[model samples]
Target: MQLNQALEIFMHGEIGIPSAENRSSRQQLAGLDILHSDDVWNQQRQIADEAIVQSHAPAEVLALLADYQPSVDHRITLVDRPTSEHAAYHAAGYRHSASEVLLARSLNNLPAPDPRYAVAQATTIADMEWLNTHDPAKRAWLTVTRLLEPRLRHSFIRLDAEVVARVRVCQVDPAHSYVTNLYTAPNYRRRGIAQALMIAVLQQAAALGECWSVLIASEAGLPLYQKLGYQPLATLTVFEPAEASE
Candidate 1:
């Protein structure tokens, strides 16, 4: 079986589609593709919501997400830029920019602050105002914040003086971590703000007694994560009804 095919099965199974598990079991036997780390919070959210709607208890839903949260949830979006092109990672402009995104690492090793830049963790979830800005790229901040409050078991933030450049960091288990739903305000890329924050997230994890962290780095972000000590674990894709078009 091909990696893509295996990935499809894993994703569908993870979403609670019955047949997906049986098929995925076979794909795993073939060692065709590795299970993904960061499956993103949205997929799990949808599955849990469906279950809750079907009559499961809220506590049960919370248990499952906390226990089996995807090992990785990572994304990169334009938060700000000199030009739309300058703000985005892809050649396509800031089409992917959004309010906030999730980032994961198995470790947290925030570098020492240099004179030019600094990195610190957000004091609290309520204090993320700098991240939820009026910039077009950060327009989704409120939405993202609402999405995370109930869903995430844990989280972290990276800040620069008054700016919040990275708004996510988390782990599903003591040893497994995932990243996703990541975004950067337009004015803050290629400046090492994100890199520093990501390091802080990982270092914090280590200090708290974690040994490994994980995340799904976007295509443009693969190299940066590599520099930060992340390696490819798997590539996953999800298929679902098109809510907007439907």
Candidate 2:
């Protein structure tokens, strides 16, 4: 539950994805862990092109932006609670874009998957494409994820052969599993599809001897995950470029 250890699991799961353009990479510079991805950086879709700072020194913030700016599109993810970094970040031309709760649950006590809904494992580009049909731009990035093979698992529930919900789990090691991309189709919400998919993945992780499962959750998802036994571990505050002044 140490913040750095949690962030390490997050960075390993979200970053380091190989890209066709060779734009995906990671490094430690200016006391920061820098991550870059070819996923076409956007504030809403924070797939990569980021620098993560574990410390709270303003000087480290200044040094990070000055020495390791990956792109104008990049953002800084501070693995700390809301603090004075707001001023330092603003002075550097970034604004607080969002805050997410980092949550974790022990795999030792996972809930059993609700057998009423059948869940399927997706292991190919075709399966990803099916799950991502609503967002075609992500296909290329998903292709890279498929290459990570053996470490990543995608599971989903289908209704009349149509994918209704899905989740991705990254087994970072025998003791750690990182969860991401948990989604349920709009009409399928509140019907237990998301919970079923999550339980299935968690059960799989537990079977693999992963001691923990972790994820960064949006405000909307915090309650549901908390219901499933995940406890908040930290707050990740993201700072991105302020809108250009007219």
The predictions' CA RMSDs to the true structure, in order, are 14.1, 3.6
The parts of candidate 1 lying over 4 Å away from their true place are 1-116, 134-136, 139-164, 237-246
lDDT of 1 at 205: 65
What's the distance in Å from true for residue 127, model 1?
0.5
Per-residue lDDT tens digits of candidate 2, residues 26-129?
A: 78775578877654432223444788877747666677667664676778887774586688778877888888899888877678779889988877667666
Q: Candidate 1 lDDT, tens digit per residue, 1-246?
A: 233332232233332212221122111212212233322232242112111011223234234434544222322222122232332223322123233212333354545533454544444545445444532243433333333442232223344443545544444445544454455556667877666666666666677666665555556777677777764544322211123223
Relative to the true structure, candidate 1 has a C-alpha RMSD (angstroms) of 14.1
Candidate 2, 18: how far from true, in Å?
A: 4.7
The positional error of residue 8 in candidate 2, measured at the CA in angstroms, is 1.2
lDDT of 1 at 240: 17
TM-scores for candidates 1 onward, in order:
0.46, 0.84
For residue 43, model 2's alpha carbon misses the true position, in angstroms, by 19
Q: Pick the candidate with the highest lDDT.
A: 2
